[model samples]
Target chain A: DVKVTQSSRYLVKRTGEKVFLECVQDMDHENMFWYRQDPGLGLRLIYFSYDVKMKEKGDIPEGYSVSREKKERFSLILESASTNQTSMYLCASILGGRNTGELFFGEGSRLTVL
Target chain B: AQSVTQLDSHVSVSEGTPVLLRCNYSSSYSPSLFWYVQHPNKGLQLLLKYTSAATLVKGINGFEAEFKKSETSFHLTKPSAHMSDAAEYFCVVRFSGNTPLVFGKGTRLSVIA
Candidate 1:
């Protein structure tokens, strides 16, 4: 069974504080992603990393950043958390080649910024 | 650009009734299609996938989806709705290369007793 682990199940941060959400995949998948889920809008991709030290911006990457220092780990960063940044964050991963579009997802981290 | 469209925002059905969730996609080439279910406060789970193999794809938990190239549609269906089947469904599309999935807004399914 493939397992994607998220470091935090829930988090609360104050405005202007720096926030970090960590994710690790035991499957050693080469591709990792960060997405913020909101009501009605659904899951919007924030950033994705296809390789260590390589990252790409997704549709909704404006208020977020990501780090992939290791093949099995990816981290999402909120430089300065704000109330509007409150949302459920999801981490996902897929094998590098010919993965057939199958994505394994983590349990998700719900963050609330006050 | 690849895109996915989930036709309904919500669908309600009683247990033992049929279930249908409509989805459509637009892609420049033959696309990889998937249906994912997300329970409340949980992560997304893959229900089924269509990758140009068989038109009809059977998935976990007695669910299936048919890929129609002519209509550019991939609709999920189940014979009977179960209480556990009540979850949010997302239609997803992935074009060739290393691109990630393009997800629809999702359709919420509610199962009534």
Candidate 2:
């Protein structure tokens, strides 16, 4: 089974603090993504990395950045946490190829900024 | 640009009642379609997918979805609703491997006993 592991299931951070949310997938898929989920708004993509050291901004990339130093790992970084940034973060990975496949997701990390 | 539309924001059904969640998409070319379920405090799970090989696709937890190109719709259905069925359901569309998956706003299902 493909397992996507999130380093933190829950986190609480103060305003102006830097936050890091890590995700690792054992599947070694070439494509990895970070998404922010909120009530009513649903899931919005933040960033996606198709290859190591290569990243693309998504619809809601503001206030967030990502790092993909390794093929199996992707990290979401919040430069300065704020109340508005409090939301559930999700990580997903899919194989890069001609076939469009469903993504394998992590357990998710819920962050609260105060 | 391709997009997915989930008709209802929320749907309530009595236990043992039939379930129907409407979804529609707009795309110039044939795209891969999927239905994903997210339980409270949990990650998303793929319920089913429609890639054009089969119009009617069966999925986990007795959930199924039918892809109708004529209506540009892929509606999820279940014979009966259970309490465990309560979750947020998202309709996703992927134009190709190069494109990001487009997710609908999602429909929250509430099952009443």
Candidate 3:
């Protein structure tokens, strides 16, 4: 079975602090993504990486950045955390091909900014 | 761009009754559709998917969905509702390969005994 692991299951940070959420996948999938889930708003894509060191901004990329230094690891970075940034963060990976790829997701990291 | 719309925000059903969650989608091209279930404080799990190969797709936990291209809808259904099946259900769509998956707001399922 494919497994995607997130470094932290829960986190708390003060306003204006820097925060990092890490995700790693054992399947060596080429596509990785970061999404923030909120009630009524659904899951909004923050960033995604298609290859090592290659990244693209998603629909809601403001105040967030991502790093993909290796094929197995993807990191979400909040330059300066704010209270509005408190939400559930999800990471997903998919095999980069035309075989109807389904996203394998991590357990998710819930971040709280106070 | 591809998008999904979940018609109901909350659905309540009695245990052992049939379950239905409505979804509609819009896409420029033929889209790949999916149904996902998320338990409280947990990640989303794939329930089923439609890739044009089959219109009626069966999924885990006795759930199924039928894709209707003419109506632009893919609705999830279950033979019998169980308490464990209560969760937030999301409808998702992808335009093509290599693009991000678009999700609906989600429908919260509540099963009553």
TM-score, chain A only, candidate 1, equals: 0.96
Q: Which whole-number lDDT from 0 to 100 does residue B58 have in model 2?
A: 99
**Per-residue lDDT for B21-99 in model 1, tens only?**
9999884467888999998866798999988799999999999999998899999999999999999999988776577
Clashing pairs in 3: none
Candidate 1 vs 2: which has more lDDT: 2
Give stretches of model 1 more than 4 Å off: none
**Candidate 3 residue-wise lDDT, B41-105, digit = tens:** 77899999988788999999999999998899999999999999999999988777777888899
Off by over 4 Å in 2: none
Candidate 2 shows a clash count of 0
User: Where is model 3 more than 4 Å wrong at Cα?
Assistant: none
RMSD of 3: 1.2
In terms of lDDT, the poorest run of 10 residues in model 1 chain A is A94-103
lDDT per residue (tens digit) for residues B28-92 in model 2? 46788999999887779999998778899999999999989889899999999999999999999
Ranking by lDDT: 3, 2, 1
- Per-residue alpha-carbon lDDT of candidate 3 for residues A37-76, written as tens digits (9 for 90 to 100): 9998889999998889999999999999999999999999
Q: Write the per-residue lDDT of candidate 1 for residues A32-85, one digit (tens) a residue.
A: 889888999888889998889999999988878898989999999999999999
